[model samples]
Target: MPEPVVVDAMGGDHGPAETVGGAVLARREHGVPVVLVGRAGEIRAELARHGAVDEIDVVHAEEAVPMGERGTGGAASGASSLRVGCELLRQGAGSALVSAGSTGAVVSCAIRGVGRAPAVLRPALAIALPAVTGGATVLIDAGATSDPTPEMVAQFALLGASYARLVLGAADPSVGLLSIGAEPGKGNRLTRRVAELLPLLPLRFHGNVEGHDVLAGAVDVIVTDGFTGNVVLKNVEGAVRAVLTLVARSGTAAPEALREVARRYGPETHGGAVLLGLSGTVVVAHGSSRAATVARACAVAHDLAGGGVAARLRDHLTAEPVN
Candidate 1:
């Protein structure tokens, strides 16, 4: 059997109960083994509540890092659950890692724990969204950096393209620059410069794609600075919730029917932004994630492990010549 996926069971907004429940669900429903890292006793209690205490193993992490807290490098010093989780992967004790904690902490810990591929200066977060064009599209640097350079954006394109092909099975992914307008000269300096660099990348660079193109799935991969990516992601999420609410209040459609529509809208799609360029799979889900979301995140982790995403990305990055 393969190694289990490591989960920071005490790090999310809902704490060990939801996190542990999700791990149990992933193990039972998905046939994926998960190692819950956190306070062993609390984890056992939560597992016992779901009557799945025996189904999963607990790796004790005496310290728990709460969501929204600053990293140790800055204002405070606290034990990061993300660090412990990533260490498990580095030690070969886990296949992949999943945590619905602080995104900053997760990225920092993963970079420190597993280290980045030599070619990547900073790891990025990429997410795949179900698009209107039947298939899915990927957006990168979703809250990983407030500012990213053209070089970083170029690297994100490569990573996103590789992931699109490897995980999503897109034969040849179309890379696009996420900008304000579809016109070549419409975006800011960073985007325009990045667009200029696109021609040098290995993938097919389809020039400047607009906001609508993201939902329309006009391109396979969309690269942007983290600030813009985060805004887009949050806005889309809010829009989805608003639509669901409107549908709920309209009474024209039954709750079941509305939910079914949402389901088809790909709401059940879970898993957080995946940190690219790490030597192992590390997923950072939202802090407020529920049990089902956590379970889905674990499933995503399983997918990455099965797909050999880490090794493939490492090979792709390392293949480039040093400057």
Candidate 2:
């Protein structure tokens, strides 16, 4: 069994209810311990509601950091639930940390509190997105850096490749540079440069792949700048939602069957994303996550923790450099 995962119970939009409920569900179903970090009273109350008050543990933090709250310089004060959650990972008291806080704040506090793995300059977020192949593909820098350099994209490819190998268990995870077209020279200078550089990496680089390639399962890993990656992710999510809606109204199936169809398109279907390139496990859940989604995030965190993802990533990175 892995160590407990620290949940930032106050970070998401729904606060203690959904966050704490998720923790309870994770502990009950997955048997992973959860340290709920937030206002102690509210967390305790939520836990009691789930009849898990005695089963789980609560760590008290004086304040709750809301979504959109800036890190270090905003109206919010210093020392947040995210900070405490990261500290749990740093101290080895927790195997990983899950939060739905501001992405920027989580990234900032994670870098400052947990620190980066050796040779990892910036931490990247890697997500497993549903594809047309009936499986998921890894898209890195989903929302981490806004303007990542080609070298950074290369680094993302490396990390993403490792994730596909270890987490997804791919033999030779084919890496793709997310571009406008499949041609080597297509896309912006950064994409072309990254496409040119990725093959020299230790992992198997599949050359340039386009957006449709993301779902086509043409490649296992897709690497791009956070700005472009975020945009593509949002658009894909919207498209999935629309498809699910149509499926529900299609009259070809019962509501329960339609729900299964919707489940296939759910954003939470892949759980939370791991913040790669960091020294420890850090999972970030969607802000609107329900209990099951949060529980799934916890299970993913447990997988990374038990697998030693961060250490393997560090070793992989130290062995290579941007070409």
- TM-score of every model versus the real structure: 0.74, 0.78
The number of clashing residue pairs in each candidate reads: 0, 0
Candidate 1 lDDT over residue span 105-186, tens digit each:
7776776677554466566788887787677888887767668778878888887887788657899999989998888888
Q: Root-mean-square deviation of each candidate, in angstroms?
A: 4.6, 4.5
Tell me model 1's lDDT, rounded to 2 decimals. 0.77
Model 2, global lDDT:
0.77
Give the 10-residue window scoring lowest on summed lDDT in candidate 1: 314-323
> Could you tell me the lDDT of residue 230 within candidate 2?
77
Per-model CA lDDT versus the true structure:
0.77, 0.77
